[model samples]
Target chain A: MKAIIVDDERLARTELQRLLAPFKDIQVVDEAVNADDAIEKISKHQPDLIFLDIQMPGKTGFDLLEELDNVPYVIFTTAYDEYALKAFEVNALDYLLKPIEPARLESAVNRVLEKSKKEDTPELKSGKLKADDQVFVKDGERCWFVKLEDVRLLESEGNYVRLFFHDHKPLILRTLNYLDERLDPKTFFRANRKHIINLKWVENIEPWLNGGLLVKLKGGQKVEISRRQSIKFKDILSL
Target chain B: MIFSVTSVVVFTTRLLTAQDFSVGMIFANMVNISTVILLWSAIYFFIHYFENLKRSEIERLVWEAAVKDFELKTLKSQLNPHFMFNAMNSIRALIEENPERAKTALTQLSNIFRYSLRIERTETVPLEDEVKTVEDYLALEKIRYEERLNYNVEIDPAVKSIEIPPMMIQTLVENGIKHGISKYPKGGELRLKAVSVNGHAEIVISNTGSFSEEEMKNSKGFGLDNTKQRLNLLYGSKSEFNIVNDNGFVNVILKIPPGGRQNESYNS
Candidate 1:
């Protein structure tokens, strides 16, 4: 696995490089002190993984992810543990705290090796729509690491799912069912067969014909919840 | 009381009504003059007393707040000396085992120390700069722990521009190793995460060990408590902190109002 250590601290980069010396399969391609530097290096190296530090001089690890057109596998390294669980829920393969133990580093690297075999799989196919998770959206020349919370609506037409967020509607070649299986049910609700709406985005809900439900999302789009699903929704929400 | 006295004086006596007055009227006027002077002084005394009391109360509150702020700062500043001495001691152990690495670590240590030394000029440093210094300190520590220590940091890039008190996160990271990870034979994992919210930053420090109430209390004596106090002092009601040990992990969560570059009026 080709990897780059992105940290403002030279000693930390050096220490991580030294720790990886025994793992011959993984090569440390380069080092970046900040997010902008990492972006330039990453675009050039296009490494398999990044030993990224959350804090840097200019851009944070998050800002780096925001700038990337294609995100490599990330294993976050830092001195604090606060964002560890949240990062794990996102796309990060693993989250390691600092002073990095050799054994843990090996295991994290080994997971990356295992993951490389299945790198083609889409990220949102596995987990809930966490507030931190950034999904890749390519709309012609423009792209975004749109947070799940920012995504107001997901409408399906055939196999393509049009993701609606902040006025841009980008279509990805995936079925609504595929997204339904991955997105957090609490945040992303199947309003109907064709649409999955973020619950947090619901601004108003009213009764519709035939025991159905109408929900107005924050962005002003209205979605209908089938009577059957409404029951389940009420149960989940305990409303 | 003055209104009643004035009304009584006005109704009981006719003042300057007569061009010429007898000695009895003169004596009465003299008494009235003294009475008016006494009433005026009485009103002035009450005003002065209440004003002084309110002023003193305000002074006390300001002093108390200042003391709390200083206590937190002193606690935070103490970490550097405490950490420096410990690093020196660790280097002492490494000198004979690996001379070259020790020399390198010593230099790295100085660099890390210098990064934080700039903190005196400003209450908060850019989030990323502080993280870099912490990472430098960890590199030196890696020499001592070898394979026993592990860590990962993931911060939202949005927060890189934000400012926080220097060494706030670093202090917690050091405490995680000293109090939680170092105890177990196999050691533990430490992870740091920063997430930028709308106008604030959320920081979490987690370690792979649990602590009893007593142990947690003991650790809170200075390290974690100091962090809590400092955060409160710096951000006041805008910040919040909580520590929870659940299912074998110790987590410290801090919500700090982001002191972005746009706002420069800090040392207030």
Candidate 2:
């Protein structure tokens, strides 16, 4: 497995690289200091995996993941344990704390090798969202590992997006545009700029103001479908 | 000059009316006596009214000065050495293990200090700003407590524009952790929920910690008392605070009036 190490600290990058030297199957392709450099290196190398640091100079490791259209397997290296839950929500392979325990690091690498093997096999892209497909949402101290199907609605509030699932709503540091690209278009419909409704969760739909439509979800929350998105909603729903 | 004329008139009348000189002298003596009495009464009333006004003005000044001093001291006392000690310890742990996360934690710590120091000079900050500061503080605590301490904050976007007393919610949250969750072996959850209800903004901090009656009675932390005093000074009877224990959880509720001159002047 080919990999790249992205960390601001030279000592940290060198130490991690040295630690990985014993794994004959893993090859250290390149290293970058920050998110921009990582992006360039990642695009150039197309490595199978990345060792990401959660915090950096400008963009965070999470920010780097946000920029990617297809995220490779990631193992987050951070000293703060607070982000462990959040990193899991982002579907990180594993989170290794600083000083990098040898046993834990070996386990993370083994998991990567296993995941790569699974990816090599051909598989159908199923319509139903799986438990492994998780979205990141941070609301104060609570971060959620939300399945795409579990999320009933995505409401836009200024610069942030609110994910509504179950009884809790978490505001994530993401824009509607950012979510629009990553979400599977078939299951998640952009009802309007202000809202993205899960297609399977829509309970009823009715005509509303100015040729638009109002979509009521299984949870009984109403979302307005704009004239532009209304057409798309109808096409997807076969109305 | 007016008093002197009255006195002169009295003297002349007294001299002229040594005996019963004439009816005119008697009338003049009576007029002189009445004028003197009227002049003295006017002078006495003037002095009394002005003195009362001056006294009230001085009283108001002293009260305001005392309140300001108390607020400053309370803010300082709340964000003292203990908070720094905990934060530094967390940073120390992060520095050796996770340099990147350590850097992020450091940045967050700086933001908390900046928000706190700026608020020390302010009477009330926008509710949005206060919420942000509390979030920063909680983020730091999350680093320390890790998974043991979890929180959920739900705030209405509309209420974000409203004004609230600085450090009011932070103090409540701190107290919830210190007196409530910190004692628990497994630790517990903390939640802050804000909503606009019935022309008032209601904030509730619910934590998964139990408190006995004795503990409740003995809850004499300076942070809680300071928060109560601040609420009283800012909103008087218009704001209310209550602590309730249910099942195995403790919840603190704070309610403040929605609309008043307090909002207008605060934004200004």
Candidate 3:
């Protein structure tokens, strides 16, 4: 996996690169000294992952994540222990304290590999999805390992998407288009540009104005299905 | 008796009485002039002495008042910046995961700034306003701690209008959360109670945590120390601050005079 290291400290960036040299699959595409430089390199290189530092001069790693429409998998590296809880809250793929251990780095890489393998797997004959298929969301002090099935709807807000699950609605740093590509197309239907409704969670459906449809989910969330996607919705659900 | 010889002489000179009358008038004028000079000297000396004493007393009072104002301003300045740093840190943590909650925290933080900027200009604020500011601070901390923090406030309506130092309760509540509750694994509860007793407004803040003798002795941390200094400056002998530990709980109690309530009501 190609990755970039973003840290203000020169020694920190060098140390992380040295430690990562052992993993042949992980390539150090570039290194950035701050959030702005990291953003530029991330757009240019399109690295599969980024090893981001929490505290920088102007903008923090969290600020970088907030700026992006679609964030690559991130592993946070920070010297301060106070931010460990907050790192977890941001749904970081992994967090490494300063003077990172080799074992920890290996474990994080293994998790990424495992995720890639799951993505590569072929579809099963069974219509029901497994619990292992989940999405991670971090919003400040709260985080959740949400099963894809539990997510009732994805509401778009400008360049971000709000994940509605349980009693919480958390806005993730990914656009609706990015989520559409990642989610399984058969189970998660794009109702419109602004919304994506889970097919299994839909409890009631009715026709609306201009060939559109109104869908009510099991959790009582109602979403408007646009006229453009209603034909596709019918074809998929055969309704 | 002295007039007998003079009367005989005056009778002989009766025909020349006009000259004698003129001499008598001249003597009376001389005595009057001397008396006026003596009275003017005494009056000038008295005015000079009193003016010097009054000038010295006024200077001393002005200097004392200035020093007291400086100390209060310093304390107010320190409290605001400290609180602002913590609140911003909390807001940063909340922004990504719970934007809605973060927004609420930001709003509360704004309220704190509003209160801080105005509080220092006045000697006291209504007990109700002070409690509201404390609640805003606690709400921000609650967002940071998530489900770990809880608080309960019990204040009598009578004392709500009673005025005390602007940040008295806020400082204590902040200490309860920062020094007491945040250190624990499961976090702890903070309770604020206010009551009026014998024309004095008493505020009690209790939190579930214990501080050892060592921590209390150090006492160099800015929050509690500033709170104590501010209390002393504002109320002097009339105010009291006591910290007690009983059954693993730390409690802080403060009391201030109730006369300032009317002054605060008009200002608010």
lDDT of each: 0.75, 0.75, 0.75
TM-score of chain A considered alone, across all candidate predictions: 0.53, 0.70, 0.70
- Real contacts recovered, all predictions: 0.00, 0.00, 0.00
lDDT of candidate 2 at residue B209, scale 0 to 100: 67
Each model's DockQ? Answer: 0.01, 0.01, 0.01
Candidate 3, superposed: residue stretches over 4 Å from native? A1-239, B1-69, B77-83, B92-96, B261-268
Where is the poorest 10-residue window by lDDT in model 1 chain A? A120-129
State each model's C-alpha RMSD to the native.
20.8, 26.0, 29.2
Q: Judged by DockQ cut-offs, is candidate 1 incorrect, acceptable, medium or high?
A: incorrect
List residue ranges in candidate 1 displaced over 4 A: A1-239, B1-72, B80-82, B92-100, B212-214, B218-220, B260-268
Q: What's the candidate order when arranged by decreasing TM-score?
A: 3, 2, 1
Q: Which ten residues in a row have the lowest lDDT in candidate 2 chain A?
A: A121-130
What tens-digit string does per-residue lDDT give for candidate 2 at A1-239? 77999976565676688779899889999999888999999888877789998766567777777665445677888756565556475544478877677789999999889877865521213323332355545455454446567888988998888888998887776788877876778778888878888888889989999999998999889999999888877887785
Question: What range of 10 consecutive residues in model 3 chain A has the weakest lDDT sum?
Answer: A122-131
lDDT of 3 by residue, B1-268 (tens): 3345445444545544456766655654554455566567767888998998999999999898888767657775335443465456556545655689879888988888889888767877899998988888888777655566799999999899987878878877877876666555467899999998997888899998886768877876677777777777666777888888878788888887887632222222
